[model samples]
Target: MITTDLNIKFYTYIYKCHPHLFSSLARDGQIMGLSLRVRRRGGSGSKKEIIPVTSCSEEVEITVPSQFQCPISYELMKDPVIIASGITYDRENIEKWFESGYQTCPVTNTVLTSLEQIPNHTIRRMIQGWCGSSLGGGIERIPTPRVPVTSHQVSEICGRLSAATWRGDYAACSEMVRKLKMLGKESERNRKCVKENGAGLVLCVCLDAFSENANASILLEEIVSVLTWMLPIGSEGQTKLTTTSSFNRLVELLRNGDQNAAFVIKELLELNVAHVHALTKINGVEEAFLKSLNRDSTCVNSLTSIHHMILTNQETVSRFLELDLVNTTVEMLVDSENSVCEKALTVLNAICETKEGREKVRRNELVIPILVKKILKITEKKDLVSVMWKICKSGDGYEVEEALRLGAFKKLVVMLQVGCGEGTKEKVTELLKMMNKVMKMNGFVDRSDSSSIEFKHVKKPF
Candidate 1:
């Protein structure tokens, strides 16, 4: 009783002068005894009991069990994984060991037949239980080990996707595609592992198989979204995607408001310029581009995509005209920023490359005027002047007469004097000559004010 009294007095002194150290000692299980209540300054009228501590001689160090330690690092195994040698080591240590060119187990000294590290769940749980009880919660908890992503897993996923495609199972396809996406996003190593295992080609095949199934719209979106992460696809995958049936199927998805599909198609097109020919054959592709340009947040990318398509496959211009892209593109120029206007003008110019394309554009009253307005306004005048030249060149005189009225003559002159590239300057010169020829045909040759058509600004560039 007297010794206990002395111990209490000593603890009270330690608590008053070095309270934090006392708490630390108590928490580490270094002190073990009866409970005593102590009041803190400004307590909320609450009493908390403190465990009385034993003397220093009774303290024992908490040592990790020998079996719980990794043989490679001789440290507690947080992620215990077993190799082909049937020996367990911490995942990090063994991975480093294998990477350092060692082919044998560090402990057993036996040759390793395979480097695959299987998670030792039994040892991991034992180590976790020991840490929780002995460490008194001082250390961080061991994380449940994550099995490394493997090429085998990716190939299996691809096989499942292929099988699902054969079976026409939308639910299974979506689940597998989402799994591939998740694994790809986990790390760069995992992405490479997935791509090298032919995941991209499998997805393309799945996308092709499901293209005609209206019931698989959600699954199509899931597949396309995954493809975005697996870009720079292989040549085989590219060919699979660019085929007529598959390419048109992707465009059909784009028309159905699948922006991810649009992005995938755009990326695929950029990968191979020759793919644009296939893109042109798709009936709804022009309409898809028009919709994307009007509503998608990445309209700039969409515009550039269509511009490349038209430039690579000029025959698509007639299709664009048939779909009324002339009016839609011209309207885009009205409110679009300079960047968007430049791309819109590019598409229009590509359309003007064809004779029917030119007529369709020239028949739109806004085409010539908007082209003339965009000349000095946009940083790139090549397409703008090119469109103007195409619309007015060899026409039935309506486009040229309209250009003279819209004061495109002076803008053409300014563009020439402003030191544009040789191509743009040449187009500008041709347009001016065309305008003058039309003016002569209209009997403005005798009027001295006929050259007044070259006024500085007709109305406004907008």
Candidate 2:
């Protein structure tokens, strides 16, 4: 029998009651079970093994270090648990962690001592799952959600950067400049803002009086160099004050102003002119962007920058369409994360955007199958659709005809056929039908294109 304010009572045998048996019941700020694994003692203890209570797995062997012995469990060479810096060698992983030893919780930014329990939902669920499994109840694993970045953040930072520039606040302006430079062309957060016109406000703020001040010139030079190199969006006089649609408005500002055109302009010449031509990195931004892609750990935004660079820059991208680049890019698609795979597909789409890009993709058969896989990701189809459309659009009458003959249409049709209970299949069918209309509009099927032959791609799904 049990008694509580809630009036809930349960019966249990005394033999089942012990600190180890009910350690999970401790609310917080309590040291519990010991894990006799992993940490080893060189000076105080010997080798021992204990099943971890916190891990939902039925058992995990922890090889305790030598010389370390748990005073509470009275176990030697066992698991070392974390309890507010009091490491007991004979303790479990969770127990040691909960001891409040850490300055900050890894999952949550909160300090451990401030909270009775871990602030992270994931950590709590893991603990709960392990506890449930111990009593023969099935453990429910919860998936952690990802945080999305917002353009509002970019605009706010840019606003500060501009304000600092306006007051001759060189020190403050330089710091903001450094932070922005580090963020560079690879930041999805900033680029999205640039696209939405919010980032332009920052550029305008920074450019004012930038040419007249030498210190401000170099600082603004570096910042604009990166933005112009990566973000190629422009319209002549598109600035809030202008009417001309010249594409190099940013680079033009640097060159036309009191800026040492000889300094930043020399560096800007090497950027991917097709996309963001305003940048001037004399040392070579291309090499830098490439290195990021081949890193052991790659970021999605970095990969996106690489793909866009390859797409918008015809000459530089020609180098990527080579056997080496396509091969490496193909492997990148193997990433299970839909965003990573989608970016890789965008790179492929760029390669197939022109006569040369198409030949590169055709020369390599791997790109097709990988693209099919990405398009097949149901939840990720929206991202891939636009890229796929580009690949199809770049095809000339002959290229379009050949691509269909090569079975490209079949792959797209498969996605439409298996669409799970959504209107997506209908949407895909509409796109395909529209493609046929475009061909006709372009005179691909009119009396003008004698070579334009009708391609039957089994119209049902594609």
Candidate 3:
């Protein structure tokens, strides 16, 4: 008797035929494919098995029928599309399934088009930037008429950065800069975020080339941002914050944090602790201007957020005091608007915590309690905790205790009990205990009530 034992076998296979051929066994598994098992021709019970057959279900490439048109657009696919393997493979709607980058199916959220399985050469080439890639100088150099750098000319610059002759010494460099100049004019028209950011890179490289030789006409802030990325990074804190050399240049940059100045201001912000000292010296001028002028909340708000990072200068402290900024912030504390209120409060909050701020003119005694009431009344965002704690310490009389009664204990506890660090939490605990004793002696908590108002400060050991 012809008999063979086969292990599991594939679903589709080329198989050995026997005379009076036996039937093929069924194959089954997780994926929609095949496997194989084999049994040898008649033999002793021991090891009577045939070798397993191999099977495959490789995806078949097919010429899409021209008659097939997308149901959504009624046009030939801008590209080839993959239909679902198991679902109703609607040929007409094939184009909808293939987007340029995403793998997720819009309808089912299942991954239908994995990146590796995609074999459409035409689809791949369209999205690839022709500029030689950062990998192995893959960009190509293209020439164009003289104009400013913009999105339209980005392709040209990308191509050059990848070229062997991408140096300033090359004849192509001037034309690259010229095309970049032209592209600059057209940038407002480039709608895509990627293209806009690409224009940024082109501007960045151009600025670097110009800046290395101290190109005066090059836009300064653009150079800073490019340097932020391309500049050789210094020791963690080594980069100068405010070089006397660059101090005036940065002050000119900080003349305002206008659209042109934001990047340079950010560079100044990144200065190491020592550099921040330099910033204070440089910023002394702005502080003087701040002291001289009466700016509205917007100006104060901008200065406060970035200025707190400068902790070194006496002039910085004096300028803040000259403006009598503490009282000016009250309106924001009372404002109903969202960002305006928060920003104003933030400036006020940062001010109160500074040692210089404590020495500056204090708010009228009433304002602190008003802020306390507001803090106790509303939901507490983590940022607002420093604001409250600083103001609470300055509160004069029953205000601190009243805060305890008004659920301030829980807020303090959260900031302490569940707080991550030992610093603020321990300080908060001390503040709370001190306030509890002061309140109990003042008779704020009745002795008989079970409110956990135990004031042990009154009891003394003999």
lDDT of each: 0.74, 0.45, 0.43
Q: Per-residue lDDT tens digits of candidate 3, residues 349-387?
A: 566656667534233443434454354334433335555
How many residue pairs clash in all the candidates, one count each?
Answer: 0, 41, 43
Give per-residue CA lDDT, model 2, range 1-462, as digits (tens): 123322211112211345354344333513223221233334443633222233223334443323233444433322233333333233343445445565554434455563222123333344444434533223233333222224555566677877887787777777866655555444554455344645554654455445445445566556555444334334321232121221233334433442332222332233334224322221234444444456532345444555555545667566555425666666676554766776666666666666776655554544434454455453666545544455445544443443343444555566677663355455466556654665566644322222232323222110
The alpha-carbon root-mean-square deviation between model 1 and the true structure, to one decimal in Å, is 14.3
Alpha carbon lDDT of residue 223, candidate 1?
80
TM-score of 1: 0.57
Which 10 successive residues of model 3 have the least lDDT summed? 1-10
TM-score comparison, 1 vs 2, better candidate:
1
Q: Judged by TM-score, which candidate is best?
A: 1
For candidate 1, write residues 279-364 as lDDT tens digits: 87777788888777656634666777777877887666666666677777788886688988887888888877777877777777
For model 2, the local distance difference test gives 0.45
Tell me the deviation in Å of residue 366 in model 3.
6.3
lDDT at 17 for candidate 3?
49
Q: Estimate each model's TM-score.
A: 0.57, 0.33, 0.43
